[model samples]
Target: MQSEDNLLKVLIAEPSAIIRNGLSVTLKRIPGSWIQPVEISSIENLEHVLETNKPDVLIINPNFWGYVDMTTVRAWSAASKLKIIALVSSLSSDVILKKYDESISIYDSPEDIKEKIFRLFDTSDTEKDKSSEESETLSSREKEIVVLVVKGLTNKEIAQKLFLSTHTIITHRRNIARKLEIHSTAGLTVYAIVNKLVGLDEIKDNFTL
Candidate 1:
C-alpha cells in the first residue's frame, strides 16, 4: 500500500489528447494514489512542464509525433529527477529495442500501464527478487551497456562513450539478448531496473547511466 504522505506524482506526456485523458483517468483510479497528468504536444512543452513541476515519474509516448533527440530525454531525466516509463505500440523492432536504457522503462500495451506504474511506485521483495534474477544473468559488457543505456544514449552514443564503433555496440546488444533470452528493449529496461544497474540516484552526476 502507498503511504499517505508519499503520493505517487506522475506526468503523462502524450501528444494525443484522448490517450492522455484516458490514461490520466485510469491512473487516478488507482486506490491510494495521487497522479498529475500533463498533456504535451511538443518536446518543448514536455521539458517546460517537467522543469516547473518536478514530477516523480514520466509516462511518455515515444511516437509523440515530434523530433525527439537523445539529449532531450536525458535532459528531462536529469532535471526532473523522475523515472521515465516509455509507452510504445509494440516492442518488436530493433530500433525501438535499441532505445532501451536504464533511465527509461518501456511498456508495449495500454493494458500494461497499471502494472508498470505499480511496479515503479511499490517497494516490495517480489520486485527485488525479480531484479536479482536479472542481475545474475548479465555479462560484463552487457552490464556496462545497461549503465550507459539508462543515461538515454543511442547505440551510436553508447558506442562513442565506450570508445567503440556503433557496430560493436550492436554486437554487444545482441549478445546481451542472447545471454538473457530476451528480444525486446522493454525486457532489457525491466532487467536493468530490477538489477539496479540503472538507478534513480545514479543520474545525479555526469556519470554513465
Candidate 2:
C-alpha cells in the first residue's frame, strides 16, 4: 500500500473551472493522491504540462479541444503512454469518448470519479509486480498472441490480421495458454480486462460469434 505521504502525481486538463475544481478537491481528499489542475486556455498548454510533468494519469475533455487538433491528444497518449480517462457529457449523442483508439473510461458523477481514482491508484503497486512476472513468462510472439487473444480475436481472425496461417495462429494460441497457465479465451479476456491490455469496449466491439 502506498503511504499517505506518497501521492500520485496527477495532471488534470479540463476547460471547465467547476468540473476541474470539483475533481481537484475530490482528489485532494483522498489520503495519498495529489492532483494538479493545469490552468491553461487550450490543449496545446496541456501537452506542454504533460511534457514537463510526465504525470501518471491525465484527465481531460475532448470537446474542449477542436476535433481536427485531437491528434495532439493522441500524440500525448502515444508518446507519454499516459493512462487517459476522459470526461464526456452524458447529454451528448454519438459520443463514444474513444481515448486515442483505446476505450475511454467514463465517469458520470463525482462518486464515480472517486471510485475510479481509488481503483486505479490503489492497485498500481500490486499490478506492477504482477505485470513484471507476467512479462517474464511470455515470449515476444507469445505476448503478441496474448494481446490479440485478450482483444477477443479468434485464431482465424488473428491469423488473417497477422498474415499467418490459421494453423500457425492456433499453435501460438495454445503455446500462449500453456505459458500463461490460462486455459480458455474467457480467462484470457478476464486477464486482459484486468491488465488493461484491452478495454471492455474493444473486446465487445471486436468479438463476434
Candidate 3:
C-alpha cells in the first residue's frame, strides 16, 4: 500500500471524453491531497502510460475490456502491481468485485469512488492483495483458450482462431480442467467472469466474442 502522504496518480482508461474529464475533476476532492488523473481514450495508449507516465492506479470502465485483451491486462496487473479499479454500472460477477484489486459501481457517486481510492491506500505493500478471482497458474495461452471456450466456441473454432491443431485445443482444455477443476462451459464462463477475462456482452455476442 502507498503512504497517505504520497500523491495517488490515477490513469483513467475510460472511452468517453466526458467521463474521463469528469473523473479527473471528481477524483481530486481532498484538500491538500495531490490526486492526479491522467486520461487516455483507449488501451493502445497503455504502453505509453506505463513507460512515460507510470500511474499508481488504473481506473477503467467495463467497456474497456471490450476493446482490450484481458490476457494482457491480467499479465500486466500481476507484474506491475498496478491497482485496477473497474467502475461499472452493474456488477454481474461477485468474483470480479471480490478478486479484482477494486471494483466500484458507477451508481455509487464520485464520492464513493474517492472513498474507495482512499481506502485502497492500505491495500498492499510489495504484493497485491489476492481475491478469489485471481490465479497465478494459467499461462497466457491457457487464458486465451478459456476466453474462447466461454464464448461458446467449439474446439475446432478455437483451434482455427488460435492457429493450433484441434488436438492441441483438446489438450489445453483438459489442462484447464485439471488446473481449475472446472469442466462445464457454464463453469468456465463463471471462471472467466470472476477472473475478468470477458464481459457479459462478449458472451451475448459470440461472433464478436
Q: Any runs in candidate 1 off by more than 4 Å, and if so which?
A: 1-5, 77-80, 90-111, 121-209
Count of backbone clashes for each model? Answer: 4, 0, 2
Give per-model TM-scores. Answer: 0.49, 0.45, 0.50
Q: Write one digit per residue (lDDT tens) for candidate 3, span 1-209.
A: 44755777788887778767877777776555578788888676865675566578887775674745444665555236577777654333444443445665443455546656665665346434442223325656778999999888899999999888787677667656755889888888888988899988789654332
**Candidate number achieving the greatest lDDT relative to the actual structure:** 3
Q: Give all candidate RMSDs, comma-separated.
A: 14.8, 14.0, 14.6
Worst 10 residues of 2 by lDDT: 99-108
Per-residue lDDT tens digits of candidate 1, residues 71-114? 56657654434566665432334465345322222311233355
* Candidate 1 clash pair list: 102-150, 103-150, 131-194, 147-209
The window of 10 residues in a row where model 3 has the poorest summed lDDT is 127-136
CA lDDT of every candidate: 0.61, 0.58, 0.68
* After superposition, candidate 3 runs with Cα above 4 Å error: 1-5, 65-71, 74-79, 90-92, 95-99, 123-209
Worst 10 residues of 1 by lDDT: 101-110
| Descending-TM-score candidate ranking | 3, 1, 2
lDDT measured at residue 3 in model 2 versus the true structure, 0 to 100? 60
**Who is ahead in TM-score, 1 or 3?**
3
Off by over 4 Å in 2: 1-5, 31-39, 68-71, 77-79, 90-95, 100-110, 121-209
- Alpha carbon lDDT at 7, candidate 1: 71
